[model samples]
Target: MKQPNILFIMTDQLRWDCLGYAGHPDVKTPYLDTLASRGVVFERAYSACPSCIAARAALHTGMEQAHHGRVGYEDNIPWKYAHTLAGELSAAGYYTQCVGKMHVHPLRNYLGFHNVELHDGYLHSARYSDIPYQESQFVADDYFYWLKQELGTAADVTETGLDCNSYLSRPWIREERFHPTNWVTDRSIDFLRRRDPGRPFFLMASYLRPHPPFDAPSHYFDMYRSMTLRPPFVGDWESTEELKRYGRIFDSRTGPADPELIRQAQIGYYACITHLDHQIGRLIMALIEHKLYDNTVILFTSDHGEELCDHHMFRKSRPYEGSCHIPLFLCAGKEALETFCPSSSCRGLIELRDIMPTLLEIAGADIPDSVDGTSFLPLVYNPQGTPRTWLHGEHSYAEHSNHWIVTQTDKYIWYTQTGKEQYFRLDEDPHELCDEIHNPVYQERICLLRNHLIDCLKNRPEGFVEKGRLSAGKSYPPTLSNA
Candidate 1:
């Protein structure tokens, strides 16, 4: 029997609630919604670590950032780990190809991808540019010339306001023709059309959009012109605590923007989503068109959620649901989809570490015993089943960092600094607005989660950044940096 192919589509900084099926009234995610209809949608899926480096590294290797040691923005994996999904699959007689942003291993960062077009997220970049072909441009791979062509001009990329971190205050351009996203789509489509017809392939096409700059093509910007926009869940700025909580960040914008600006931002976000959706649609259609759809296992997800001023924060790094949760859609083959449902939705919590092992299982490849994640194929197929008792995520945001662990009914998070660790019960307070670490009622549960975090840190070496910065037991090294 011929092995099945896997097509994984990942979008950068997408929210879990934006998918139409997730009940966002304005998001035009028809393809995603349809995929949801046929596939298994993990409603509570979360990024193991909210930051790009931790989250993506975990996704690439089936180990948490703590184990993989890819903690900071520029940290690269030392090459002892063997046979990533791409490498293993390729070795198993599969052609592996990757497209778009996968912010990991800086140069030629194909963990296992034999053919790749890597695009790191703009949010991850501390710099910005419009020149498509700068000799000094980061990761000057094959996508540059195609970017120049589809995006019209290199100068427009910065001017057009599609840049993810571009300030929302910039003067608007309603008639801008091409954007970075268009180039992404064009290149992806070309990649698809040019794929080898005979080989079983695992193609991962990543899209960076609905992320920032709040810019899109003229058509995408006009998507929500006549629609009534949904305000932020916590829109009121009366509370000083929330404002004070995010005082450290530079891009925090408060006070209201012009309705048009808000609309354009939302519209830009939706447009990017719709734009990406169409690209995935084309991928699916190509699969069907080439008679490859039936054998292809499609998985769509994002690195982390973006905070569109949810708690008055702009980009993601916080521990809020807005920043932690992401959309996980798995359009299992016809057999898998036919057996999908909503009964007791994927019971126990699963983390980013689980993805690699799961992908290895789906691909029918050998699972590296070094991998830290447990396969969820049984959970995906079993309507009443789920994964582990807890899925954990950790992030070192500035001097303050949070460790998240959740069970089916209970959620726990611990953030330590200044010789104190704060814990919260998300079941009691789903929004996680208050810290109950000191509370006597949940002391036992809090202690359990704290122990878990400690044990996780114990797996690393003494000199490891993760072990030193975030210690479970032995005196943690003073600072968690290369400095």
Candidate 2:
């Protein structure tokens, strides 16, 4: 068999339930839904960390956040950790390229890639601000530079609002118009058409949408109105005292309940997702139009899910399903897809870290034994294969939460600050409305999973195996503090 090209599509801040195929009947993600039907969509896929910096690092290095120590988006980038998939693949001779967003430091600076088509992050050059004549900006510097370059005078604009709605309005959209979500299709199509025919290329086109500033064209906005949408399946998580303790109004860990406003925000979010769905359709059709759909592998998923007003809350931070359960799908050569999911079922527990190894295994590239995740190739082949049931996800943020180990039947949540432990019988309570954590009857299961979390925390692998390249703030200066 010949080596096939790889196309990894990653969306930012996408909620797992926003896609039509992901059980959201009202949402229209036609392209993604079609991919799920033809490919392998992990119905129960999740992210290791809910924050962008942490989760992206885990996905890139195949390590948990604890290992990478990238606890949050606002946190500094610990540069000396592990060699990323990009670094490994580019060195292995693939014409690796990434567009849109690479939150990691030193964009296009080869954290590992031949060259990036879009330098979309932030920039802090001395020439621009007259700050200083330094050689560079922050490693993962400016996220808006590409938009600035593409839109010229139009880029010097800002629309402020706590809601994604104002951001989605014409001003922000046109301002960030070179937004990878809008222009990524153009760059991806160009790569597929212009790359040397001999080398198998690996292109990762990351889209920033369905994230926030949830405004979209009237066409998509027309598809959803504040009045027509459904509130979270479980909005008042405070119904029970056990759940009540975890409830918060907002993320700086403050705010009051404003139900109507949250509802409107959600409507905007749905609009953003629906808009992204249309863009994805264009990108996928381009794959088919350029005649690369058959030979190339297309994988679609998100970095992390946004927590939109679940439990009177409006962001990601907890181990609730809304924050951790991300969507993951793979569509490619029939043989390879069959080899991974011969059973043809879109149900299984998958982690973000597995993406790297799965891509490597499918391309017949060598996966380093040192990497933390196991390739889901076998599970894909036998979707029901003696299911590999255990996946480890971690978090270290404002509260110093330890780790979470979600298995086939139960989820054990451990927090570092209070040494808090809780276990939920997920199969019976998909929404996790009940906290059986302290229930005496389920104490046995709780204890068992609690042990797993402890193992993950105590014996967990120290992260960013780059001997410091990926962990310590060495090779790379800190990440975007401007955020």
Clash count list over all predictions: 4, 30
Give candidate 2 regions above 4 Å deviation.
119-143, 160-180, 235-256, 334-343, 400-402, 459-483
RMSD of each candidate?
Answer: 4.8, 6.2
User: After TM-score superposition, what is the CA distance of residue 185 in candidate 2 from its true location, in Å?
Assistant: 2.1
What would the per-residue lDDT of candidate 2 be over residues 391-471, giving only the tens digit for each residue?
A: 777665545444677887778776655556667778887766666767789887776666665555453343322322212
Any runs in candidate 1 off by more than 4 Å, and if so which? 75-81, 121-135, 149-156, 161-163, 166-178, 235-250, 253-264, 335-344, 419-430, 433-441, 458-483
C-alpha lDDT of residue 460 in model 1? 44
Supply candidate 1's per-residue lDDT for 387: 71
lDDT of each: 0.64, 0.64
